[model samples]
Target: MEKLLVVEDDIGIQKQLKWTLDDYDVVFAGDKSSAISSLRRFTPKVVTLDLGLPPDAENASEGLATLQEILSLDPSCKVIVITGNEDNLNALEAIKLGAHDFYQKPINDEELTVIINRAFFVSSIETENAKREALECEDTPIIGTSPKIMRVKSMIDKVAPTELTTLLLGESGTGKDLIAREIHQKSRRNTKPFVAINCASIPENLLESELFGYEKGAFTGAQKTTPGKIECANGGTLFLDEIGDMPYPLQAKILRFLQDKVVERVGGRTQIPVDIKIVCATNQNLREMVLEKTFREDLFYRISEIVIDIPPLRERNEDVLILSRMLLNQCADMLSKKFTGFSDEAMAALMAHSWPGNIRELQNKIRSAAVMSDTKLISVMDLGLDDTHDELDFSLKVTREKAEKEAVSKALAYCDGNVSNTAKYLGITRPTLYHAS
Candidate 1:
């Protein structure tokens, strides 16, 4: 249920109001202490607050105090102040102090319901916008000049000209965002802002304001009017990252925006139209999110208007060496080091190693090696792969035996065959020495 808290000192009015909003999970607070207790305890996203309380019902002082406390405790809480119908100025002051909006006394059940429902609706939209941004931020720049990398680039060059809402599917750290930006940069919208937001990182409560903006006094703490990311990126591309994590309700709103090219601000009455190219990226199976009711089928169709699935690092082995060199150069330049190259053994290790972490892992390892290596060229030891040399350094069992025999023979030659001393010095028993000979 959508949680809501109604704080008023009048017992009859409180009980009657609670019954009216039976659709919501309602919590009532008769006094300031109880109200704050409920606030911190539940952290309700939307609050219905009376501006007149026990200590100062004739004035708004007590109610204003409660508003300030709510904002201080949770700056994002949407507190709708309840004031006497004649107290317009007090309501405006409360707005400045961060009240979401105000509802006058002698409440009209229908109008109050509209305000509360708007809060819940707007709060839901904000959540989905944040998750969309999270999906976007996880991408990176695909750095390489290999034939395979070049082929991927070729596809990007070709497809970027269209108005398709490209969906880039790849593992984390594979530079999906980089490719997304590249497509946006190459497209007709190159000059416009390439606004990117991660969907998963932002909380659902504030995500709406971040995307659709809100009217001044839309709720307590919505002090001044502000435009969301969507308005900020009017003519540019709005890249929604991790689109799958977007809450279901928001998916519907986004689909609405996609269809009508218009958005309504949180607690807003009129629709705000926006024009921009939309590009989304995600690693999750959105098809499954839709199946489980977590993702919207309509939005999946809206964003996946075009899909570009980039191959993972292991699948594109041909680009490994090329990507490594480029990434190493980036490290060298960033670290201000002149790394000559990798040692022969180091090169072999780099090629042989199974890089499960993809380009990002290799980049970090090489960057570290470049900073720590003593020689101009980094060695296998520098990359922490010296154990890999074991097989390559050994030829056969005879080689091991001959090497041991030569060592014992040399010691004997030096000591003129002092058997007891030689055995003791070599830290070996006589039986072992006899077997070696």
Candidate 2:
């Protein structure tokens, strides 16, 4: 169990905090001496230090001393100082003394809980990242020595620093969205929000409202005013996934909005100006769509100022093995399962197979293997792939799975009153069921 050390001078408040942090194994202390002793005993990852302790219950002198000592002992510990409503001075002092944060007294239990929970969540992420680094010498989203993936990574390193409108083209599951996120995280707007919307997912009627927001009286369901992802991500990055699916009419409006950094909400006459970078991704062939008059050439030019084409997984030579190992670890973490890795046969099969569905198919197969593998190591059979099957077998297998049951029932009914077997006549299942109730 995780430990929480609560140091408060008042016995009543100490008991209250002890019960408040009941989810954790909480330790309580009354004064500086008791607080130090508890800290030494618990070595807690999280500690709540009240600003007023004994001998200094009306002041922060002794409380500051306790904070310093806890830091000197365990610098990694998250020390959250409990402060008075108007005690900003001591809070600042505590912050300068390395306190993670200060919570005002007479706190809303929910707000305090959110703060504590977020602190712990961040702490856990950092701890996991550290462990990952220790196990592997490096960390990067794009992994491989393949020329295609390598070029994409090199482009990200260069383009990520700029505020350019980038359009990523690839097949589905080719990591287009991941590349967009990499651009956001590595860009000058790294600290800002990275908003993503799927153009294909939202209906054309609602896509306008989703991109430009709506006023209270915009539509029948518009109960209140709301900002869309584009406006919400102002001063950040807005990623439009499946840009090819964007309707033809809406494309004109989006083009105007991109040309001028302003948008008019649905059902409202006012124009709101916003500043944001755009990153668009699609699994469709935009050039072909342009030739077919489905996609707008003007809008295409606007988004594809800097285009990056990502290759499908089948073309990336050694990336299959690298991606598999990385995917294996991620699957293990999410499922909370201990999967050492895939079998040698599985790795070879994955490497040789043509990933027509690309990275997304690989991801699904890994997830299936992780959940269904009979042992710690997964095999090619677990992937449910038929690499060696001919076209005839493939067609036969699909037909049997889909239509066999229906055909069998029809045959049995037509052969009514026959006391012997049916599949012995049909030859579908092993040890066929005998006929006649």
Candidate 3:
């Protein structure tokens, strides 16, 4: 049973509440100091605070102070303020001061019970979501446990220590930049600079000078000589984002630099020697571009010494809830809101929607929902997503059976097909596991 703290001064009322809210392990406190002490010791998720306490029973001064202190100690604690029957103003004030809800002196047992249960439910959801977030590996840059993501991580671990020119292929917003940085961090040149340049974002005429620096008199705006991204990334990693968009003319120069490990400034004959690891990312199909004569075939081969393909968000179904919970927590902290988690409808909408924009789209939806939502739980409407999709099946029995089957299969695979170990891992009996399988 969950713990509940009752901060009533009257002995008769305290006994009555203890008997009424017998569903919880009730802790009693009559004054402000003892209330705070009990709060610290028991750490109850729900607290019933009475405004009529000693020293300031006439007004709501003492009780209001206690409410602020309780919230200060544990901001997530649901404080249900107990106000007088006629104390409408103090009740509103308590709510404004961050009390979860206000209750009248003549508290109906059933009504109070419902409120307490709701608070407990929200608290449990938040706690479990937080635990799920904590389960992610801190050392990894990527955040997913799906088979596709696990394979990507394993490939990264293997290739990060090598000097191969890696090419990452994926759709936009698939976190290609993150993978580049992870590879750089895990490489021998981690202590050196890691420079990035987007081929598509920069202008065509200036892209060459951006990759290979220009001399002081190279152009009208070139008043001073500057090192290009490649030179700056000496003994480090150079991340060429959207490499497929790099101009065909500039590809020859990049290939020359890669082959010779030397750079020549624009309009300068000096050969600048630089040792750098190259990591390129592109959302376009480079092979098709090469066949169409848009991207140079030789340059493609030079850059793609090793290729890593990132799976889109739509294909990573198992990671949707994990990423959503993590992103929601981030948005809540950034917006300073006390959001617990998504509602069942919102979760169904998240699973049903095809994330064309990938992780970036998911992030935007979560942040927008956090800003627009008025309650602790985010709804499908708050996410601005259609929940009535044909793909969504609201059958509880089917959903449970599917989830159980997947869990058992994965557990069995993890345990090397050992039925006893799989059952132990799933916290189910051997017979139950066999039936589920």
Give each prediction's root-mean-square deviation over alpha carbons: 34.6, 27.4, 13.3
Cα lDDT tens digits, model 2, 1-437, are 36778888788776666657655667888888888898888788888899888897899998999999999998888888999999999999999999998999886767776777666666667765664564366446766666788798889889888877899999988988889999988888878888999999999999999999999978898999998888999988999999999999999999999999899999888999998889999989899999999999999999998999999998895678778888999989998888878776677678777888998899899998888887888888887766563322324235544465666677778768352445556643434344211
Give the candidate number with the greatest TM-score. Answer: 3
Please list the residue runs of candidate 3 whose C-alpha ends up more than 4 Å from where it truly belongs after superposition.
Answer: 1-134, 391-437
Error in Å for residue 290 of model 1:
2.4
Q: What's the lDDT for candidate 2?
A: 0.83
Error of 3 at 128 (Å): 12
Q: Which residue pairs collide in model 3, if any?
A: none
Q: Residue 180 CA error for candidate 3 (Å)?
A: 0.7
Q: After superposition, how far is residue 418 of candidate 3 from its true place, in Å?
A: 31
TM-score of 2: 0.57
Which residue pairs in model 2 clash with each other? Answer: none
**Cα lDDT of all candidates, in order?**
0.80, 0.83, 0.90
Q: By summed lDDT, which 10 consecutive residues of candidate 1 come out lowest?
A: 389-398
* Residue 290 lDDT in candidate 3: 96
Write candidate 1's Cα lDDT for 250-289 as tens digits.
Answer: 7777788888888888888888889888889988988888
